[model samples]
Target: GRHQANDPRPSHFEYNGVRFGQDNLNVFAGLCAVDTPEHVEQMMKVLRDNGQVCTRMGAYKPRTNPYAFQGHGKDCLPYVFELAGKYGIKVIAMEITHESHMAEIFEALHQTGDPTGVMLQIGTRNTQNFELLKIVGRQQRFPVLLKRGFGITLDESLNAAEYLASEGNRKVVFGLRGMKTNMGDPHRNMVDFAHVPVVKRLTRMPVCIDPSHSVGTRAAGPDGMLDISHVVAQGVIAGANMVLVDFHPAPATALVDGPQALTLPELPYFLEDVAIAREAY
Candidate 1:
């Protein structure tokens, strides 16, 4: 069943002791294909300089082609925790591809002495993986970030969150990563900005926008930072409690998703725009 617009679910949830809801906004920089410890440091510096610390550091890459640059895997988990600690990042988001991977993730965290903070991410491709959802819901150690599937409807999106809630782990944050459409545009997907407010009104969970995936474009071309900034601002004004942006110190040299990633130099301006937008709401 759909969540009634008037449903009495909690509107805010705490992650690592910090609350996220109407008044607070969580801005995360997504580091795609971060393969080395040096890259981790570079990304952390960017976030720090911008007065932002937390990031969506990709430990596993869900690539379509076998030849693509998959992420640094388990070997890089320690670096993620270590570097995040050195930089004072409060929360770091990492993907969990399967139920089996959960053990490995935990083992890595445990070895690292359980870093500062962690958020388990259910990538867009695994949003509807019921088995994984059930497992994540049962384990309440970390909060879950559930991204919207490329072409999934709002009902399906909410239902996916329900899977986690049903298992008694209601600490779920909903992410809107745009939708698949036949539009002939350079962007990777058609970002459904309207859904931001809709999700906010329908559920008690916090809503986030993934502008990097929504406004996909190669960095070699004209900068799409402006476009991304616009959508992020729109999402925030529409009711999003967080905005996830993919950024690389050198986007042109990124192993994966370089086109949609914002270069280090461009991030500050975009973030400034986001700050202004945030003030309006």
Candidate 2:
């Protein structure tokens, strides 16, 4: 199409040794939030043991409920970076709600001597925060992961991502985190895996799926396959380049999104399942 003739940005981006659109399956799995140093230590240890170096740690959680746990924010940054460094983690996928959060993360990274890198996340809650998006776009130190708005159309989400690219940071990964409608009741949100290919064709950004948030459950259904396992299969088979899911040392006590968080013990089998799915593709 003539539309792509003028676009000069590459069709993909790379981070932590994993290049998207290259058929390399990179899994970003970890706690939904940093609960304590003990938990961070355990999560990093398990990830290192599994040979997984990328993770998702929500230091600034944006909850719908005002009283809900809103993450430890800057307070937990030092220890989280320390633990990530101790265990050889390369990139910690952390979310930033406000522009200042970026500075805080940078400060923490500086304090830690930059032992590990961080992939800045623009969560679903702030998907349309144009100001924040522009701020992230101006930064070149970290790559960006922008999640689809839970209630907006796909076009809106892609346009929002353009806000970042237009600001000079073309290293962006588009994430599909499902919608907030009830049409997908009995599940968290309507499974949006069908759009994996659509997103790939529409933009140069690599597409990633958050099966954890899309399915909103770790339990299995009548098929006896864990919901997350099934959801991930759909995304991987449909041409997703990366995956971002939630995992915890103990889901029963996770401060946020505990019900959908997979336990640490399930890591091995889950990894195997993803490997098989990628092979199936």
Candidate 3:
């Protein structure tokens, strides 16, 4: 593997003083398509009730359709920061798409007084956007979360992380959100569970799995939660340092990724299963 051969292994890193790659399991509840203060409050309550303290929020959504919900843009960031403070969340992961977005992010941080630590996420669509990666790497103000592209190989994924590290920012986390495959039986993409340990050994960066997108199933009842719990448990046991799942108060009306979003009621049980799985490791 190129990662194993040429790359200098990344050491453990911290976000807001919480060290990853240790015994601690970082659980990031994905809050996708959040548009208003009301949604923020609702999601915050759900997270706090379950003792979850970190979230992957998107104030900027890049959609396939121009008419689709393009998130609330950067204006809603203040509300996210405000609610994150009220809920005591320590880390918030948000995506950066262009060089111009850097100014908006800095302005939001200034206005919100930097309530919680911000992690710059490079979504699957932008995994190979080297220009954006280099720009973000130069900032060095926050850590980077690089999700593997659905169609990219393991080598390409590692190289994407190297792009950031080459720019002198080594605080990078790799997200394995499943790779695109021909099998379309039950999930959107086939999750390569074996990649977890391989990535840990090759890059030494903290690895997280996005089961919601990987499984590609909607929560109907306890059965849906069961399906999600199964995959999440497997990911943790496979050596993932973090787990990222999407949850909404009402998925039926969620503006984005509704089918894969777990309803609020099912979160506690899912988190319990994740905790037990991490203990097994």
Candidate 4:
């Protein structure tokens, strides 16, 4: 928490008139400890409360602390999707670390009509995970959210995308969260800002920015919400095809990454600015 530095001031607010970014964004409302029928119910509640039509449902969790919940794993997936239908929330479940779990991932999709399509997110731990990538790509039921590694170079990051793309999975979506760990600074991870445009130029697929992880703090500390507006706008201008912003109905009460979440009122207003920023690109 003691690692904040004087970054540039947030840019002026600008609302562009673009119809939409290259790909319309789907805010990922994650459920980490969803292990029972009750957790499923809570998922729907959050979705409804936020007016969120869908989410990335995590039945099996990977947490840094072992004391954390590993979730009900595959046991609660169907029930999760079942509740989603009951609440009209499209469900996206994560696969277990083993190929054996692929069965359950597809099963959930099949049972749910797959909604907007299940997403195979390659988390930081899975950046260089080729075996997993090949396996996820093998499934045709969903798209992917390929998060860049903490310190992975831009080329290496794009190359991971290339591997997925080569498998003919055009639905691959690239995510950025910047690299700052090796620098021994607490300035939050600076997303590979240039990746926004670089990936767009090298591949025909879509790209989006994950700014919550970029600056690390969700609150607009000294600068205010304009800080978010400026960073996202510049990201778009720099060639980010789309944005993957994380927003919650309430930030302080969030179970995960609460500090980084933008308030509900903040999202649309921010998107208005993002839509405008994207128009400039």
Candidate 5:
């Protein structure tokens, strides 16, 4: 259904006492390789300083690479949650696997002392599983932040959100990352910021951008942050209500997608000129 500006149709919800998509603009740093309490604390510091939030997983995901890092799974979740609790930071997490482990995932989320309020993240790989999407939306005890499929179109992405909403769940905020294309381009992925305004106009789902996964290149240049920030500025101006980016305490030593993750200390500067771009163009 179409939405009016006064209605604020897609309202944000609180997770673990932290809110997303409110009138107050907020950002979240996706923590993929964050595996320790110390790193979690450091991440919270980054989030606090930048006024952002982070999402780390409970299960160690190596993702098809036989030689990926498999840290402590549920065992590590508790520590990360404990540290996040202390920092007044929000967390968006992937629920381990599908059904067979739903009970365990719920138990893990509940132990965070925030089952009913935490943010549930569904990554691209699991985007089209209608059954799974329905479960996450219908039975979910918390707010959901759904990610766009790297290979999906704008409509397909919105349909994923509609998948949840159609199932009696209205607490959803759709995420728009990037799509992959072979347009004689060398960039690893295409950041389709154009979809931002489109989605917002169609259904009132607050749109969020993920430049980390959208960049066409997996290789970082000397001035990586500046380059990424330039694109990010374009996204916000295009009508993105929020952003979900990946950053690591030490990018050079990260375990997953090292090239795309922002250096912990590089965030503030990236956000510096964004407002100027927003106001000027």
Candidate 6:
């Protein structure tokens, strides 16, 4: 069943001062995965200079290829937190696959004296991981960013979100990360930003759009419009509360999703374009 359009459940989800929908467009930009200390520092510094505070830091990645560069994990937490703290990044959206990863993250937070906050991310691959969903929901220390399942129906994805909210953690941001279907063609995943408003209407939860994963490439289209920029504008205009995209000091050498990651130098223009799109909304 769909959540009632007028459901009274609080839809005001916030983390480190960025209130979804209530505040200005929230953008979470950073590397798809933590790379070198220099790269992280560079990206964070750029973000700080540009007046952005929230970012995506993938400490643990869930990949289809078992041998893929599966993130640096807990080992990179200290420096990541240190850079985050140093650059005034208040919150980081990070993923946790296994339940134990939560403890590991908490430990890292403890070691860093909680300088920066982490919003637990449940990637699309784990949207239906019932046990993990329950574990994440029970914890109140962090908000949850639940990406729609890459291979499931929109209704099924929303139900999966219920798995988290039912556990009593209602501060959830439903992310539209496109889908795994081939109907999208030329692109890696189907661009699903059209559902941004539908999600808002059907549930009392904020909506975020991951343009990076949706298009899975930073290439420009026939119209000379970069695919990422176009998709981002579509979501923002559709009332998306947050934007999650990827950036790297050097995308060419990025360990994962290199082709999809934007270069650091291109960030300001992207931000400007996104701001314009937000204004259009």
RMSD per candidate (Å) reads: 2.2, 1.7, 2.4, 9.1, 3.4, 1.4
> In model 6, which regions exceed 4 Å deviation?
22-24
Which pairs clash inside model 1? 217-259, 218-259
Q: How many backbone clashes does candidate 4 have?
A: 5
Among all candidates shown, the one with the greatest TM-score: 6
TM-score of 2: 0.95
lDDT of 6 by residue, 77-153 (tens): 99999899999999899999999988998999899888798888999999999999998988888889999998989
Better of 1 and 5 by TM-score: 1
lDDT of 4 by residue, 72-172 (tens): 76777677767766776653534355566667767766876653345556776677788877777776556666877776677787777767766765566
- The TM-score ranking, best first, is 6, 2, 1, 3, 5, 4
Local accuracy of candidate 2 as per-residue lDDT tens digits, 93-180: 8999999999999999999888788989999989999999999999888999999998999989998998998898888889998888
What is the C-alpha local distance difference test score of each model? 0.81, 0.88, 0.81, 0.60, 0.65, 0.88
Tell me model 3's lDDT, rounded to 2 decimals.
Answer: 0.81
TM-score of 6: 0.96
- Model 4 error, position 159 (Å): 2.5
The backbone clash count of each candidate, in order, is 2, 0, 0, 5, 5, 0
- Residue-level lDDT of model 1, residues 1-281, one tens digit each, is 23676766667777775677755788889587676788788888778888885788888888999898877788888888888878878788788888766777788879888765778889999988999999999998888889998877788878999999999888888999888888776677887877887887778888889988888864232564367777888898887888888888777788888878887787688788888988887
Of the two candidates 3 and 6, the one with more favorable lDDT, higher being better, is: 6
Off by over 4 Å in 5: 2-19, 22-24, 53-62, 70-72, 93-102, 115-117, 216-225, 274-281
Task: Give the residue spans of candidate 2 off by over 4 A.
Answer: 1-8
Worst 10 residues of 3 by lDDT: 1-10
